[model samples]
Target chain A: MIVAEQKPLNEIKTMIADAERVLLVGCGTCVTVCFAGGTKEVDLLATSLRMSTKLDGNGKVVDEFTVQRQCEWEYNEPLKEKLDDYDLVVSLGCGVGVQTLNEQFPQKQFVPGLNTAFMGLPTEQGVWEERCAACGNCILDKTGGICPIARCAKQLLNGPCGGSQNGVCEIESDVPCAWQLIWERANDLGQIDRLMELQPAKDWRTSRDGGPRKIVREDLRLVAHEEE
Target chain B: MTTSTNGYKVGSNLERMIRSGEFVVTGELGPPQGHHAEEIREKAALLKGYVDAVNITDNQTAIVRMSSIAAGAIVVQEGLEPIIQMTCRDRNRLAIQSDLLGAAALGCQNLLCLSGDHQSFGNHPGAKNVHDIDSMQLVQMVKNLRDENIFECGDVIKEGGPRFLVGAAVNPFGDPFEWRPYRLAKKVAAGADFVQTQLIYDIPRFKEFMKRVVDMGLHEKVAILAGVGPLKSVGMAKYMRDKVPGMIVEDRYIDGMTDAITGIEPLPPLTKRRKALKAQLQELGEDDPARAEIEAELAELAPRIKEIQAERNKNWREKGIQMCIEQIQELREVEGVAGVHIMAIEWEAAVKPITEGAGLLPRPNVGSNGSG
Candidate 1:
C-alpha cells in the first residue's frame, strides 16, 4: 500500500492561508489505512485550523469532507457539489489524490496536505517500513524475498557491501542489513550456493531510468482505437 | 602464471610482478582535497622504488579529493606505475567506461573497482550517489571492455579499449564471516585479476579466511594482496576497531598503541605545572630566590616537555610502522597471500619505512620478464 503522512500543521496552514474558505479533503483508501488522511484526521485538522486561525485574529471558515477514493475521478465526483463553496482544497490524501482533484476540478485550487512516503505496510503497531522500490523489474526470488533495491542503503546487488557488521547496516545500528537477512534466509533454505553465483548488473531500463512509466491494457480497453 | 601472447594482460608492472611469481607490494596515495599535484608527486616519490605500484584512491571515504585518474597521471609522470581506483558511487556505467578509457589513455595500466564509501560520510551528504553498477559487475564490465573489445551496452569499440589489470576489494572480516571467502571467489569468477582485502589487524581471523580460500583453490585463480595500514595512535586503533565497519582491530594492537605512549607525560601536566609556577613567581617579590629557582625549572621543563612530546609522537609512529611491518611479514607466510598493499593514507612517508622494515626493499623489476 502507498504510505503517506500529513504535512506539518504550520506548513499546511501556510498553504491555505490566502483563501477565505478552505475544505480539508481526505481519502478513504491507502492514506486512510495509514491513519494519515482518514475522515477522523480531516476533522481534527479542520478543528485545529479553525482554532489556530481564530487565535491568530484571521479566523476563516474551515470545513471537512471525505471521499471514498480521491485517486479516482468518479469517487471524487461528489466533491464537485462542494467545490465552489470553498476557495481552496487541501488534500490530505497521497500525491495521486491531489493530482486527481486538480484534474477533476481545474478551476479550484488544490494543495497537498500529506507527503507520499513509499509503498509499504505497517511493520508493527504504528511503525511503517518501505518494502518495495517499484523498480519495475524484481529479483526478490534470488534474494530470498528481501528487496535490496529498497532496503540496502546502496542498493547493492552483489552485497552485503563491506559495511554489514553483526547483521546491521553501517548506515544505522537499528536498520538490519538487507543482504545479511538475505544470506541468513538463503542459508536456512540451504540455497547458500545460489548467492555464490554472480548476479550481473541490473538492467535499469524498466525502472524510472526509462522515464515516467504507463501501462496500457489493450485487451481491457472498452473503446478500441484504429491503428496508426 | 598466465600471460598473453605479446605480454601479460595490460602488461602492467603490477600484473608483471604478480604473474612473474614475485611477492609484490602496492602502496596507496590519497589525493589531497585541493588540487595539489605536487603533493601527489611528493607522495609518489616516497613509494616509487619501494612498491610495485601505487593505488590512487577515488574520493575514498566519500570525501572530495582530486580524481584518482588525475592523481594517477601525476604518479605516472613521476616515473611510477599507478593502479587507479575507481568507485561505483560517483559514476554511472557511461561515466565509468568513459573515465576508464581516459585513464588508459593517460597511461594508467591498472584499475581497482570499488563500491565507494557512502556519500553521507562525506562533505556533500546532500549529493546523490550513482551506484549504477556494483563492484562485481564493474570487474566483469572492465574485463569485457578489455578482453571482448566491447562496451557494457554491447557496442563494439571501433578502435582500442581500455586494457587494465583489474582488481577488486574484499573484506574477510565482513559480517556473515563464513561467506566472505565465497565473495572473493565470486570476484575471481567476475574476472578480477588481483584482489586487495580490507585492512587486516586480527591475523587469526584472516588466517581462517585464507584457509577457506585456499581450500577452495581460489589462490590459483586470483592474486590476493593483503591490505595493511599503520595505526597512528591508540585513538586511531580504537576508531578502526569500534567505528570502522568490517575492520577488526584486535585488542592487542590497541594495547600496543597505548603502550607506545607509556611513561611519556601528555604535556598538559607539564604545562599545568609551569602555569602554577608562573603564578607563584608573579605573586612573589621580583628578586626572590624562590622566583629564580622556579624560573630555572620552568625554562628547563618547557623544552624538555616539547622533546618528550616529540619523542612520544615518534614512538607512536614507529610502533605503527613496526606493527604494519610485522603484519606484512606474517601475511607473506600465508599460503594464498600474493603481496602486501600498504595503505598509509596521508602518511605516505611511512610506506618506505614500513616496506624497508619488512625486508621488502629493492622491489623486483619485472619489466623485462613479461613472458612474451
Candidate 2:
C-alpha cells in the first residue's frame, strides 16, 4: 500500500484559483487505500471547492471523476473524452498516478493534490505505517518475517548496534528495535544460534543502484511490427 | 394563535433566553430503540422543570437510533423543550430541509447539526452512506433557511419562518487537536449558535482549549457546553484508552481507581505474586547457598500457581456504581467549565443523581444573559 495525505484545503484552492473549469480526478488504487485520493474523497473535495469558490464570488464550476487505476493507459484512456471540457485537472492520485495523468494528457495541465509518503498498510483504524521499501530484494526468511529495511532505523542487516537499549531503539523511544524483535523471535524458535553467523555485505545492483530496471520474458514478448 | 403549541414554533422567548447563556441547565436524552413512547415520556417527566432543554440525537453513528424528529415531538408533547440533532450522513439537502421543516412544525426550536458518523463504524456494516453534504454545508443550509426562508434550490416555503437556535458538535480531544477551534469557527461562521463538544476526561486540556476558543472569539459567538462522561469501571477506562480513537485517559485517574479498593489487588499474579515470594525466600536463605538453591525451585512453581489463581479471578464480579459517582464529582469541579453533557450510555437512569451531586440541577427559567 502506498500511503499519502491530502494537501490542505486552502493550498488546493489556491492551486486552481485562476482556472475557469476544474476537473477533480481521483485514483482508486494506492491513494484510495490511504484515504487521500479516492472516489469518496474526490466527491468531497469537489463539493468543498465548489462551496469555497461560490463563497469567494469566483463562481467556477467543478466536475468530479475517478478512475479505477490512474497509473495505467487503459484507465487514462477513459478520461480522454472529458479532457477538453476542463481547463485544469486536479489529480488526487499518488505520484505515479499523477505522472501518468500528465503523460497521457500532454495538452492539458495536471496538478497533484496529495503528497505520496511511503509503501505502508493500515496497521489499525485510521493509522497507516510504512512497511516496505520495495528494495527489489526481500530477506524475510532470515529475519523472522520482519522487514528490517523498513522497520530498522538504519536498516542494519547483521545485528542491533550499541544504541539499542533494553530492546528499544535510542533513535526514537516509540520505535522498537527491529533487530531486538528478530532476536526474540529467533530465540522463541530455538534458533538463537543463527545470530552467531557472520553474513556477507549485501549487493545493491538489483535495486535503484543500477538505475531504472525492467524485466522481460521471451515467451511474453511479441514480434516487432507484425504483432500490431 | 393556539395556546397549546402543537407543531414547531420559534423557540419561545423563554427558551431562547435560556440558550443565550442565561442561568439555565441543559441535558441530552437519547431515545430508546422500538416504540417506547412511555419510556421517553417518563425520562422527559424526570427532567421537566429541572432542565431547560433536551437534545434528541439523530441516529448517532449511523446506528438504528430512534428518529430525532419523533423523539423531539414526544419531548414537546411532554411540555419540555427539544433540541433536534440533524446529521448529513443519512439525508440529502432536500430530505434534510423537509425534515427541518417537519421538526419546526412539531415545535422543536433547538437544532444541533452534525456530520453523522461513517457507516463503516456503525453496527450495520453493509449500509450505504449518504454524505451528500458535509457538516459545514448543512450549517449553511440551515442559515439559508434563516435568511431566504427557502430551500437550497431557491423554493420558498415558509416566508416568515420561526427561528431555529442551531448548535454543532466539536471534539477538542480528538486526534489533530489543533483543528478543533478552527472547525468550531467554521461551524460558527456557517451559523451555529452554540457548540457541544465530545466527552472530555482531561480538564487541563479542556482549559487550554477554552483559551483558544476565547482567542478565536468563538466564545463570544457561541455558547460552549463542556461534555463529561463519568468513568464506570476499571475495564471501561482501559477500553476507552485502547479502543476509542482520540481519547486520552490520564494515568493518575487509573492509578487512583486501582488504589481506592481494599482486599482486592491490582497486579497480575504472574509478575507480582511470584516476585514477592521469590524476594522473601531469598532473604531467609541468604546465609546458606544450598538453601537458596532450593528456594529457586519453588520460584519456578510460583508461576504455575499464579496462572491458576488468574483463571479463578477471570469470572470474579465487581460493582461500578460507587466509582461512577466519584468520577462525576471530580469532573464538575474543573475550572472554566460552564456545564456538562451527561452521557450515561445505557445508564441513563443514574443521570439525575449524578447531576444533583454535581449541583447542576434546579436550572433557572431564564439563561445567564436574562434574554430568554
Candidate 3:
C-alpha cells in the first residue's frame, strides 16, 4: 500500500495563507492503513488549520470531507458540488489521491497535505516498512521473498554489502540488513542454491528510473464509447 | 558483457596494468576525517612510488572525510594513479554522475564503485539515506557515461563522458556462500572491469569462492583483486570479528594470540607476587636477609616479565605480517585471481611492508599504456 505523512502544520499553514476558505480531502485506503492521511488525520489537520488561522486573525473557514478512495473519480464526484465553497482543496492522501482530486475538478487548485513515502505494509502496530519498489521486475523468488530494492539501504540486487554487521545494517540501530535477512531466509527455506543464479542488470525501462510508469489492462478497457 | 579491449578513453597506470595482464597491486587511502589537505598529500607521498594505484576512499564508514575526488586529485599530484572511490550512501543519481564527471576532469581514471556504509554508523544518525541506486547501478552508470556518452537520465554530455576502469566490491565470506560468485558475475555483467572484495580473513572459504569463480570462467571476463590487510593487534582482530560486519574471523586466529602468551609458564601477576612475598616475609621475621632476598627476586622478576611481554608483542606483530604474506602467496596461486587490494584501514604505514613482504614491490611500470 502507498504510505504518506501529513505535512507539518507550519508548511500547510503557509501554503493556504492567502485562501479564505479551505477543504481538507482524505483517502480511505493506504493512507488510513498507515495512519497518515486518513479521515481522522484530515479532521485533525483541518481543526489545527482553523485554530491557527483563527489565532492569527485570518478568519478563514476550514472544512473537512473524505472519500472512499480519492484515487478513483467516482468516489470524488461529490466534490464537484462543493467547488465554489472553498478557495483551495487540501488533500490529506497519497500523491495519487491529490492528483485525482485535481483532475476531477480542473478549475480548482489543490495542495497536498501529506508527503507520499513508499509502497509498503505495516510490519507491526504503528510501524510500517517498505516491501516493494514497484521496479516492475521482481526478483523476490531468488531473494527468498525479501525485496532488496525496497529494503536494503543500497538497493543492491546482490548484496549484504560490507556494511552489514551482525545481521544489522550500518544505517541505524538494528535495522536488519535486508540482504542478511534474505540470505538467512533463503538458507532456512533450503533454497540457497537458487541465489547462485545471476540476476541481470535490471531493465530500468519498466521502472520509474526510466520514466514515469504506467499500467494498462486491454481486457478491462471500455468496450464501446458513449454516444457523443 | 562487452569486455572493452578498445582501451580507456582516459587511461591511467592502473588501466595499463590491467591491459598488460600483469598481477596488479592497489592500496586504499582513507583521507582524514577533517578537511586537512596536507594529510592526503602526506599519505599519497608515502604510497606514491610503492603502489600501482592509490584508492581514495569516499567517506568510508559514512564518517564524512575529505571527498575522495579531492584526495585522489592530491594523489595524482603526487605522481600516482588514483582509484577514486564513489559510494551511493549519500548522493542521489544526479550528484553521483556529476561528481563522476568532476572526478574525470581531475584526471581520476580508475573508479571503484561501492554501496557505502549506512549513515547511521556515522556521527549523523538521523540523516536520511539517499541510496538512489545501488553499486550495481553505479557501475552501469559509469559504463553508460563512458560507452554511451550519456547520463543515467539520458542527457548527453556536451563534453564527452569520463572513461573509467570500473571496480566493484564483493564479499566471498558472507552467508549463502554459493551466491558469492554469481554476484561477482552480475557485477561483471553490469560492466565491472575489476573487483576488490571485503577484508578476507578466512582463507579456506575465499579459496573455495575462487574455485567457483574460476569454474564459472568469470576470471576470463573480469580481473579479481583479493583484499588483504594486516591485523595490527589482537584487540583489532577481535573487534573486526566480533563487531565488524561481513568480516570472517575464525576462533583459531583469536586463539592463536591467546596461545602465544598462554604457552609460557605464566608468572603470578605483580600484585599477587607482592602480596604473597609480604605474607611470607611476615612469617619468617621482618629483619631476616631472606626477606631481602625475596624482595630482590620480586624486583628482578618484574624486568624479566616485561621482557617476556615485549618479546610476545614482537611475535604477534611478526605473526600478523606473516599471516598477510601467506594470504597473498596463496592468492598468487589461486586461479582466476588477478592481484590483491591492500586495505590497511588506518594502518597506512604497514602497506609498503605488506606489499614488499608479499613480493609486490617496485611497482610495475605500465605507465599510462593507451593501447587496446
Reference-based TM-score of each model: 0.92, 0.52, 0.68
Could you report the DockQ of all the candidates, in the order they appear?
Answer: 0.64, 0.02, 0.25
* Clash count (model 3, backbone only): 1
Query: Residue B187 of candidate 2: its Cα lDDT?
Result: 73
**Top-DockQ structure, candidate number:** 1
- Candidates sorted on lDDT, descending: 1, 3, 2
If both were scored by TM-score, which would come out higher, candidate 2 or candidate 3? 3
Q: Fnat of candidate 2, please?
A: 0.00
lDDT of 1 by residue, A48-74 (tens): 999999999999899999999998999
By TM-score: ranked, best first: 1, 3, 2
For model 2, how does the per-residue alpha-carbon lDDT over B1-372 read when each residue is reduced to its tens digit? 122233323445334543445533466778877778987898887766656777788887567878999998999889888888887768866688888878877877788877665455567868765545556666667766765576666677555443577777877775335445655776777777667777666667777777788887777677677766555556666786665545666775565445444454444655565676667776674586566565676677676766654543332212233444455465445433445566666555556666566566665544222112
Candidate 1 lDDT score at position B209: 96
Q: Candidate 1 chain B, which ten residues in sequence have the lowest lDDT sum?
A: B1-10
Best by lDDT: 1
Tell me the whole-model lDDT of each prediction, alpha carbons only. Answer: 0.90, 0.70, 0.81
Collision pairs in model 1:
none
